[model samples]
Target: MPNIKSAIKRVKKNETLNAQNTKAKSAMRTAVKKADTAALNNDENAKELIKTAIQQVEKAASKGLIHKNAASRKKSQLMKKA
Candidate 1:
């Protein structure tokens, strides 16, 4: 219920950005889960999975969907698990 036109436009833009961020976050989580599972299973491709997960975390951080330190921490943990 924004009264000003600019306020309404801002709200719309925020909604779009929120959706994009949510999607990116969801993808990051899924990638992390896959990497963890692969590591747990001792799969031969676990290294690749961990690498992909690290890349996803980095991309999410770059896109401002997650904090840089958080992404780096995640990557470090994933590598340790692998």
Candidate 2:
């Protein structure tokens, strides 16, 4: 409901960005969960999951979707449990 034309455009752009970020975050969480479960169960796929999860986390951090410290913390925890 932006009155200004630029504001309306910005709102549209923001909505698209929000959707993309939400998808990325959701995928990251799912990857992390898979890594955690695999680690706990000693599954053979755990290594792959951990690798992919770490990559996803780093990507998110690099994109500014998540904080660097949080990314490092997640990677550390993921590594620790694996």
Candidate 3:
């Protein structure tokens, strides 16, 4: 535990931010998985799913939750599968 009040506040803020980032990453992964499944099944919505997945991946990168190169790689792989 932090003895200083500012340090304590910072710890709490960090916990919150960590949770938010975890959630975002989870959502991004889920979106990518969905897109992959759609592509594998040859669903009509695969393209749309890829679009949304790419957007989510980009959003995560913009928020610094994931690396920019990783995000680009994901988008590239998704497009390739689509």
Work out the TM-score per prediction: 0.92, 0.97, 0.96
lDDT of each: 0.94, 0.98, 0.97
lDDT of 2 by residue, 1-82 (tens): 9899999999999999999999999999999999999999999999999999999999999999999999999999999988
> Cα RMSD for candidate 1?
1.0
Ranking by lDDT: 2, 3, 1
lDDT of 1 by residue, 1-82 (tens): 8999999999999999999899989999999999999999999999998998999999999988889999989999998997
Provide C-alpha RMSD values for all models, in order. Answer: 1.0, 0.6, 0.7
Backbone Cα, N, C clashes tallied per candidate: 0, 0, 0
lDDT (Cα, tens digit) per residue for candidate 3, span 1-75: 989999999999999999999999999999999999999999999999999999999999999988999999999
**Which candidate should be chosen as best, given lDDT against the real structure?**
2
Root-mean-square deviation of candidate 3: 0.7
Residue 37, candidate 3: C-alpha displacement in angstroms: 0.6
Q: Any residue pairs clashing in model 2, and if so which? A: none
Off by over 4 Å in 2: none
